[model samples]
Target: MSVSPFRIALIVDGEYISAWQYLMLERLLASPHAVLVVVIFRQSVATTLSQRLNAVLLKVLHALDGRFFSCKPTAQTPTSFLPLLGDVGCYAHGSKRYQTFVSTQRVDVAIELTGQAVLPEMVASTTHGVWRHFYGNPVHWWDDYTNIREYARRQDEIVSGVVRYMAGQAAADCVFYATTSTDKVSINRGVERTLWKMADFIPQRLHELATVGEALFQRNMRERVLARPLSSQDAVAPGLITTCRIALRYPSNFLRKLYKFLFRQEQWILLTTSHGNVTELGLLENFHKWIPPRDRFWADPFVVEQAGEQYIFFEELIYARGIGHLACVRLQPDGSHTEPVKILEKPYHLSYPFVFKHQGQYYLIPETAGNHTVEVYRCEEFPHRWVFEKNLMESVEAYDATLQEYDGRWWMFVSMRSHQSCSPNEALYLFHADDPLSTQWQAHPQNPVVASAAQARPAGRMFTDAEQLYRPSQNCAGVYGRGLNLNRITQLDQECYREEVVSSYLPDGDFDMNGMHTLGIGRGLSVSDAVYIHRRLGRLDHWIGKLSGFIDQLVWKHCYVLMVLPLTFLWLDM
Candidate 1:
């Protein structure tokens, strides 16, 4: 039997609508099992000089490019414009015309994307409920760390913009929420671009919102529900003096850049400790460093134990190639290691050599996403030679392809970046197959099961402790690979997927490490990698290294151009 779509209505601040908000509306219209019945746009009186300028610019653009560049109602659904002559919340709720329209449409739910507070009494008397979408720091408006100079200058603390959705009319009634960190580049581009970036995942989030809304409504009917008390963290608007000071200091960031160029070093270091010690301490202590030769680093370490012997596989990145290859080393019982050996190489960049054993056969699935394919290789000899096995997936940009077997199925968890995505590490995708090497893989109904950089990217191996399966994820909140998040997989299937974060490990010891991304354990030994700033050379060497790395990146980006240039010269000479 076919079920009816949820009838939804939007209450938006027409004065604030931009290209980004339009994109959100477009995505909502595209969602399955959801129908936008009516849109109510509340127009606010323009006060600021910037607001007045924007209004005039929008009018001119609309005259030239038509509705494409305008903030007016463009969706096919019915819409009504309401002018707010007084307080926005009180005017909206008290207007008889608005109330009549809501009654006529019979909206099952209402959503406010205006970032304005709606009274709880008004919301309860209206539709089933309302959801509010906030695009900046909800608790605090201005912070010293805001990505945009405008906001930073105005506020003393950094402005950490959040794309958040809160349920219920009151602030305390927020039941479901998701947050993504905004960088300076994104914030300076304005709200339209921010919304456009968020549009990639907001559609999926709306579906989740609908599901949660229905479930909460039913539960509310069965039992009395009370709103949680609001916390004391209130936001204060920024003053002009603070804003001017911040703007003046913004240009001085070049000094910090120069300092970083002079002294900053990013070197990947590997460490080993007892598994029990890691669980108890929540941080690794007393570790031995596995430092490679000059201008080379070892990372993404995977360990395999066989016949009382341990072998560690990692990605060895050399400065010249500017690409990584699968490398291995033998781990001795006395905690010493042998020299590293290159095991596998390809013309394209490769890293995250995820190795595992199945049916007594050793197989490897390194990140060949740069080549636009996911492939498996079989090790013919221990820790040295490997032959191409099969392509599990193709034409996809997937990273850190981690695999595990559960409930008689082979499941692969990877971070996928869509062509439209602004960041690659934020979206988590799943694929399952009956055979470990099967090419016929099925995507989860909810492909991007998680969409936050803080928890989506797979870091290393998945293991079971006390019958509970835990997956290690990268915490890319402040920076990529900043820490490790351990999540317990509570449910997994075609229709549904869920996981809860159990514990986290951060680099907080003597290493002065900035990041720890990978974690692997086998035969009572756990291996992890930490990133630290190492000043390896003086100023001259540093500049040379920088130039070399730049050239490598250029070569990687336009290898095809280099190939075509030689061919073109040969043809011209002939």
Candidate 2:
């Protein structure tokens, strides 16, 4: 049955919008269920001298700072978003033209794109009320400048998007929430990346609201993932003294960067437990370590046991090649290991070798996100040969495809990104099918079941013990792959999904440890991976140091990029 598309109206200040905001409009226009019926240009407002100066300063800093990380807010052009703005004209909120147009076109939804505060009258006019975004702390102003505050606090940013419905005249609904970490190196990339990802959810939610009526759409509602709405005590911008104090730390950071470039090396190694469940991983004494050579990193491990022999499969990425491939190593009885053998290699990069035995046949779903595919492989010969199976999902930026058979169906948990500009480590998507090898998969009603990077990326396989289901995930808060989050699934189905973290495991600072992410348990053994900031000079580090020296010489000779490039860690974005 063909249904009428829901009428969508955009509230904007002329044609000015962020590049990510333009992306949201294009996505909405592309959705079959949403029609951009009108674009109401907001009433013009004057900018104060201080506001103008602040804007210029922000632009100059961003342009200079973007060289370190090639991410900056895009300058706008009319032709870029003009086509998507249907029937555009300037109008006040309560103008006669606005009312007549809304009544005639039957505008179903209103989206605020002007960075304005949500008004009570906006909901009273539109049928489905207004949709707006708040990109900062949960309980802050609409357009809070949070990068400085978050950098100063060393905390993750909770980026939120909400829909204000006219239900008895109240505006408190955080419909979309993603609390993700900023970039470890550049906060500009971190902030921009988090905001760009919303291009996926804003339109997807509209489709759901139009396809399924409001009653069924909100039925079996998932848990609210945001903190309280904006409170009056929250300051929109940080204090000047506080920002100045934060900026003074850059000198120490610059010194530390030199030391790190010359002496530090980050390495990932595999760890195996003698006998421990997924929930309780036990102490360091229970683990046997497998350290790879300094040239390669072995991660995303999976295990298989056969006839008193154990085979460990993982992704091995050489530092020189900068690409990952599937490899396997045999575990010896005396807690030693044989050299790893190349298992599978393709033109594109691969990782997260999710192997399983279904219908007496061995299958593996390695992360082929490089090819934009969630591919399954069947083993023609054990531990050596693998042939192509079917593509479970195509044209998706999905990572760590983990499958579990539960409640008479097969559920797949995968982290996904909307596009290249967005980060995939913050959202967890769910899909289900009748059989493990089913060709068609059904997406959950609430697509992004979990939207926090702290535990969104799957770390290992899901397991059941004592009639309880547990899923392990990577803790990418402030840094990627920093720890393990052990979560218990309270509910799961097509309509709704929920999970709660029960425990956490972080590196104990032994051997200069920094992080642990992947985990797998089978046949009385639990295997995991840990990363350490080892103090050793490798071939790669040597070249980086050499390059740093060259850049330093150029920076010293010319004062052009001195304040911006040489003192790279500045007040612009920490």
Output the number of the TM-score-best candidate.
2
C-alpha RMSD values across all candidates? 13.2, 6.7
List residue ranges in candidate 1 displaced over 4 A.
11-16, 48-101, 115-128, 137-176, 182-197, 209-213, 216-233, 241-245, 248-252, 278-284, 380-382, 387-396, 419-421, 430-452, 488-503, 536-574
lDDT of 1 by residue, 1-574 (tens): 1336667666666544544445555676667856776566666434577545544543343233233324332321223333312222322544786777645546555666553565343366444456544334445321221233333322211212223233342343433223343332223322222334544444554454455455633442222112112223325443333333333333334444566577677788787876773344237565556767768888898889877799899999998899999899998879889999999999988899999889989999999988989999998998799999989999988899999999989999998864432455767888899988999988775557775656889989898888888888988754567788888888887656678777787773235566888987878778888886675465564566567557645654454565467779999999
Q: Residue 178: error of model 2 in Å?
A: 0.7
Candidate 2: residue 214 lDDT (0-100): 72
lDDT per residue (tens digit) for residues 1-574 in model 2: 2458887777877666666778888888888988876677776568677556655554554564476557664422123577655555546667898777655656677887765565555566677777776666434533325355565444555455554556365545555656657654555666566667766667877766665577655552234542223323344445543344334334434765777777887788888987665557724556777889999998888888866798899999998888899999888888778899998988889998999989889999999999999999999999889999899888888999999998899999999988676677888999999988886888886778777778889998887877989898988877788888888998887766878888888774554567889888778888888886776655665466568667545543443444446456665556
Which structure among the candidates has the greatest lDDT? 2
Q: What is the C-alpha lDDT of each candidate?
A: 0.62, 0.72
